[model samples]
Target: MKADAFPYRAPWWLPGGNAQTLWAALASRRHFGPAPRWQRSRWNTPDGDFVDVDQALHPSAPDAPLLVLFHGLEGSSASQYAVAFADFAAAHGLAYAVPHFRGCSGELNHAPRAYHSGDFAEIDWILRRFASEHPGRPLLAVGVSLGGNALMRWAGELGDAAAQQVRAIASVCSPLDLAAGGHAIGRGFNRLVYTRMFMRSMVPKALKKLEQHPGLFDREALLGARDLYEFDNLFTAPLHGFRDTADYWSRASAKPVLHRIRVPALALNARNDPFVPANSLPTAQDAGTHVTLWQPAQGGHVGFPVSHGPFGLPGHVRAMPEAVGHWLLTHL
Candidate 1:
């Protein structure tokens, strides 16, 4: 989508990337509508492991379009963006499901491996299963942050065949270029804030995975890791069958394969996103005809706040999801 056509405008009170991002994470929940009642289902993966998918409870006609949301790293169905989309899906009479990436649904996964930005194979099977169950119902998908990159990678890898499983897809604040994102998140304020925030949960989970499978990786190396690159080198790369962090980031990035997407897809990124540098984003020509690029001037990471509350309180973070969800629904 063209920049002018995009609907997000960062509120004056929520100026810059950091403020908007922090508010969306910490305060946006209160501004959203009623929390969605969820029914959780466990699906055993083909690999002898299982993933839990949370379906939002909403009264809608049978065979209504199913909206599958893939949450970001360490994010689940209850994430701020996921909950907001659940509200949007309910209002539009759509079926909504958020599939938790392995080990993210609360219970530690049985498998030694965990989710990553380029986990397209995992995305492929999960989406395929959803399609098989839904049958003729229209299937629409939205991926937030890391989930977005994985979903797009799945699309690009399948090319024309992706249309069979999903009608349309949208990604919000995804770091399509994994190498750039990895480097960006490793330095300065981003390293101190966002990287540590993610590592706080990630490191502990990885250590637990080691306990599940002895000698999976070096415990000292994992413990000594300070940034995403070091962490991935110790855990994410080897377990997932990559040479190292360099190999993983280069091979996992969706930007290189975006032009291969055959179905209608939207790749929305904020120019100000701290995790994803503006220079690393793909252009319209780079993404090809089937993809729509929305690089707005603001909206940090997955945070897009439109309206400030009474007396200049925190802004409401529903505009991005509403706009993106509408776009998905329109294609259906």
Candidate 2:
């Protein structure tokens, strides 16, 4: 499938990359209607840290399709995209789960390790547990940004084994090439806006974690990181056992292994995404037969705003859920 199969057009009122990217966390928050009651489950890892999984299900249905959602950098249950997707899934009577990365589930996670862009082991644990708990239901997934990258990487690495776990998968606005993505978001205007937003949430949590596990590293160096690369170099790389940011970025990127994926998957990205450049977006040939890179020219990052809808309701309709939801509905 190509981008033409599921066309998306941004509303004229909200033009440009900045408008669409920022609106979800700003203007679109007020439009969130009644939310689903998400049952929370916290998993304590062998490493002493923990991750949280929030499940939103249809009360009447004992068995339903499950879409495991993975949020972006520093995002949680309250993140604009997560909340919107949860409610949207509930409205559609789909069973969904949102797994919060370590140190991102309201309270600080224990131990020295935290989540990174390529935490495939953690993702595998979550997927395995969910599959076991649900038994026979068809398992699907939709990952946003960082989580999307890891999910794609896992699929690529697993090859045929992935098909057994997930029937189909969707990844939105993920940084397939971590080195390219880092360079794009680590400089110029993105450094000021996007970088600041990520750090604002990440830094506090890092500091708190450092306090819990003393003598871990230099706190000042972490506080001084001005870009994504620098943050990885100063804290994430060392904590995760990588030599440097380059090492971490290169090893964690999904681009190198995408061709190995055997499960049917859709990789959606906006050509004008602020953090990921158009040149870095995957081509159909690059993704092999199992994957398609559906990139629209205009939807900035994960935002696909449409002014008109079924009842003429106007707001930023999140494309991640719309595309993934529609695909899962028909494919499953």
Candidate 3:
């Protein structure tokens, strides 16, 4: 599909153009072929927990700006999006790091509380430690979907306090408005597909967490959940100490913090994204001077695939590491 044909470019409240290119790229879901080589490492957080991370070095350069990558919900180091971005980083002589959220690195986390969308503290802890260890090395971040929300929240919260070693940030397909996104996903066929996929991953983890801590979750409420909102309301919201789903969504939504972002950052979203609508984007007035909101016309969620000859590639995923790498090389 032609990127210009996307609905986001129709002079809507949310501007399009670049965002449309990103959306078309994501919707293609093109695979980048083989996975790149990476070394597995672990970092000890301030809380005495070890988070698994995959560090991939650029094939050409030994020392380069580090791109800290974050995957979407239930995505890990093995995810196609993660690997594709890592490959792009490698191609650009940019080292990348993929931090596996708790219970996502092929192993259950020691804590009962799993990772969530608004967990900025964890990213902060990781970045601080990485900076301390790497010292003067330049660092940037790129988050996908849920990971995008986390990074955005962190960037907004960091403001001037964000480490100087850090350079720029890029977020793709993030649901900035958690409440609206959640509401959208709970209706129609979208609900069926999303709920099934999410629960396939979530329910198992929830069950495991429940087994680990018997009284942690309400079994009845969990079993009765018919949608993502109901599931989060029953489990995620209560587990994190929110009043309910509304409170959790309100607090976790990144829209309230976009204007506060002080660092150079790029946010990409699709107008036709089944998960997040164009309305969820931050207004030009609301977005700080440092933030560049790229609302593409066609990328569906994190699925950006562009076929080239017999080999197609997801444009958004492919462009992400390069975009950040080039941005950091030029700006930072």
Candidate 4:
């Protein structure tokens, strides 16, 4: 789909990227209405770890399309965007599920390894399990931020094989170019605000991981790390088997493998997204014929707050998900 055809316009009341991004976290829930009920299930991983998944409580037809959401860093099923998408799926008579990455789900994972942006093996396992369980049901997947990059990597790695597992996929505000995004988030106001916000939870999680497996990484270095780059250097890189921050960012990036995706895929990003640099976003040529790029001038890292509706009235954060969800359905 074309970028302008996306039908998302930032509200005058919610100006700029930061405001839109923060509004989704702080206020979009109120406007989007109450969150839908969720049913939690724990799945055992092949490596003896457990991951929790939250499925929307609303019932759909037995053959209804299943929408699986892989959330951003430090995000869960209860996240504002996840709840909003649940509501959207319910409204459209679709089944929805949100799978939490290790360490992000309330409880820290037992294994010393943690999830990362290039954790496509984990994504492959999760999606394949979902496909197997649902048999003939059509499956659709959407990954937000970190999850998106991983999901895309999985699709690219598997190539045409992915077409059998999922009908379509969408990535919202994902940092496709991890190197660009990693350095961007560690500098300027992004470091002060967004990076700090993520580190608060991440550092504690890493500390807990250290406690689980003593001497996993340096204690003082982990504590002293100021930004994601430093934090990854101290903790994430070693735990996930990367040599260092540089190696992790480069290899984990989804940009280089975009051309390998054989299934229909949508990569949506805002030019002004605080986390993903505009220059790093993929074009049609970069992503290949099967992938579509939607680089709106606004939306702010999965925060697309609309000002006007079709009736010329107020709009909410549901606009982006609804549009993306419709796009996914159309591909099916």
Candidate 2, residues 1-332: lDDT per residue as tens digits? 35555577777777877788877566664224476567899887777677889887445255777878988888877777777777667767678889998878788877788888888878788888888888767888878899999899889888898877888888888999999999999788888898898889888888887898898878888888888888899789889989999999999998888889888888988888888899988887788888877888887877776665564345756555766688766767
Q: Model 2 — TM-score against the truth?
A: 0.94
Cα lDDT tens digits for candidate 3, 227-281:
8888888788887778888998889877789888887877877666888877877
lDDT of 3: 0.73
Q: How much does each candidate deviate from the true structure in C-alpha RMSD?
A: 1.2, 2.1, 5.2, 2.1
lDDT for model 4, please.
0.88
Q: What's the CA error at residue 157 for candidate 3, in Å?
A: 1.1
lDDT of 1 by residue, 266-289 (tens): 999999998999999999878998
Error of 4 at 37 (Å): 1.1
Off by over 4 Å in 2: 1-3, 29-33, 57-60, 308-314, 318-320
Q: Compute each candidate's TM-score over C-alphas.
A: 0.97, 0.94, 0.86, 0.96
Error of 3 at 267 (Å): 0.6
Q: Once model 4 is optimally superposed onto the true structure by TM-score, how far is the C-alpha of residue 145 displaced, in angstroms?
A: 0.5
Ranking by lDDT: 1, 4, 2, 3
Candidate 3 local Cα displacement, residue 230, angstroms: 1.4
What C-alpha lDDT values do all the predictions have? 0.90, 0.80, 0.73, 0.88
Residue 315's lDDT within candidate 4 is 47
